[model samples]
Target: MLPSVTFLAKFSPAHRRTITASAIHLTPWQPSSPQAEHASLSMMADKCKSMDQLKQIHAQMIVTSRIHDTFAASRLLNFCALSASGDLNYALKLLEHTPMPNLFMWNTVIIAQASSSSPFEGLLLYADMRRRGVVPGKHTFPFVLKACSNMKSVRCCEQVHAHVFKFGLDSDLHVVSGLVRGYSVSGGIGDARRVFDELGNRNLSIWTTMICGCAQNDSAEEAIRLFDGMIADGFEPNEVILCSVLSACAQSACLVLGEQIHEYIEEKGMELDVILGTALVNMLLRTDHWLKQNSAFMD
Candidate 1:
């Protein structure tokens, strides 16, 4: 009988590791009906509410020799690596035990680890993937770059940026967006801008990324410039960004920048309504107040 969920939770890390290892290494066999069996087992794995339930399904797979199927192994791996109740250490163990892990499995583990408290683990997995000759698809770099973004590891980011070009994934919107964010976090606004400029098909997301990247790096002037360009490029400015750039402008306390926001709202006739009229009213009051302060200082 499997340990109760509460009992399993109470086990020491070492004991848990022992149990996970024993559960995964169940006597191996090649199932005669991997397709049907793995599919059904995968459904059971997906619906598992706790590790105990997952272990039961996993043991069933082993007994039926369905664990040899990559799809079946990956389902268990995905649940363990990603589910809220799942265990990452157990998932890593599963990755090793799988006879042949596929790109999806590798990516699933990488994605989970990249977003974990230890992002370097994700980077390590990426390096291991390269060592094993598992060619990364375009979807892979964004997650890899996400780790770099989390770590603020500019050098790692730059290395991954090189890999982006090497793999010809530089044009992937998500990849470049991640690159822009990674660069921005490390105060490499120029690198972010260069990446932003390199991409030809700039969606609102990419535009927002570059603009927010600028705004965050204290490059308010650049943010305002890009915001202008975003508007010129036929993209409507959303209120979140509108206020972000507006705050930067208000902080710079430059009347010209304040006027630019007003001009943008008035000129664009944007109907993506967001209580912007109140924002514009506040902008005018602040602009008036800013002018008063400067005028008094001149006196």
Candidate 2:
């Protein structure tokens, strides 16, 4: 129901003039007061209800010579790019107008788009950044890799994987985890495994991604094997890891293993929230069904 960027742009000329006319109102402000300036912008950004409001504020900032204020711009862009009050299109428009967007701006937009319904836009933004000769930071790869994961685009993921190595982020925990997830979703489990094997001090997220990826991609037995290795390697399983292992148990009809997991949950006092509860309950139901079918056959 919010206005689109194109729709909002139609009124920019009028809004710009209105802001320019009121430029004298902001003359009392001093650039020496960075904290006060940030506070004022933050409060205004927090109160913004629509793209028009944001554009109006942006216009005012321009007239007040605060156009290049990174903090103010970040707050505004974060609202536009990530919050419900704004649109991705508007966020993109804002970025397009920025004379030189910093890495934080790029990362924010990339993350917002990747997490949006149309995730492919994040990849396009990444391409745009590359064409502009912007060097991607450590935070940049994970979000774009997430876009690759969401689209299940193996070719795109492969290109990003190469970029990871090129940028010397191959060993970065979050980047490697993203690569593992991207490969897993793209049905390149072998590549995912290769990346997993190369990790020296594997974290819970990396292990969870590989296990969940295997469970979802028809490698349930491998998931179980990895779960065992995770425990043996001293990584305590979280609810997410347990849920994935439970799913693998359900797929394999391994009642013994499922029961062990249930006992482990009790031992660890892990909360059985909706997701983990559903996984455990489904595992139990599937195991019982398999047992009944087997017993029926024997009878």
lDDT tens digits, residue span 1-299, model 2: 32244543455554644543354243333435756655776677767777767766776566544657766777778888988878777777778878888888899999998888888999999999999999998899999999998898989999999999999999899999999999999999989999999989888899999999999898989999999999999998888888999999998987789888887987787776778877887887876656533432343
Question: What C-alpha lDDT, on a 0 to 100 scale, does residue 26 get in candidate 1?
Answer: 36
List candidate 2 segments past 4 Å from native. Answer: 1-39, 46-49, 289-299
Pairs in steric clash, model 2: none
| TM agreement with the true structure for every prediction | 0.77, 0.82
Best by TM-score: 2
In model 2, state the lDDT of residue 289: 58
RMSD of 2: 6.2
Provide the overall lDDT of each model, using Cα atoms, as 2-decimal numbers: 0.77, 0.81
Q: Runs in model 1 with CA error above 4 Å?
A: 1-34, 254-299
lDDT of 1: 0.77
Best by lDDT: 2
Candidate 1 residue pairs in backbone clash: none
Displacement of the residue 158 alpha carbon in candidate 2, Å: 0.3
The C-alpha local distance difference test score for the whole of candidate 2 amounts to 0.81
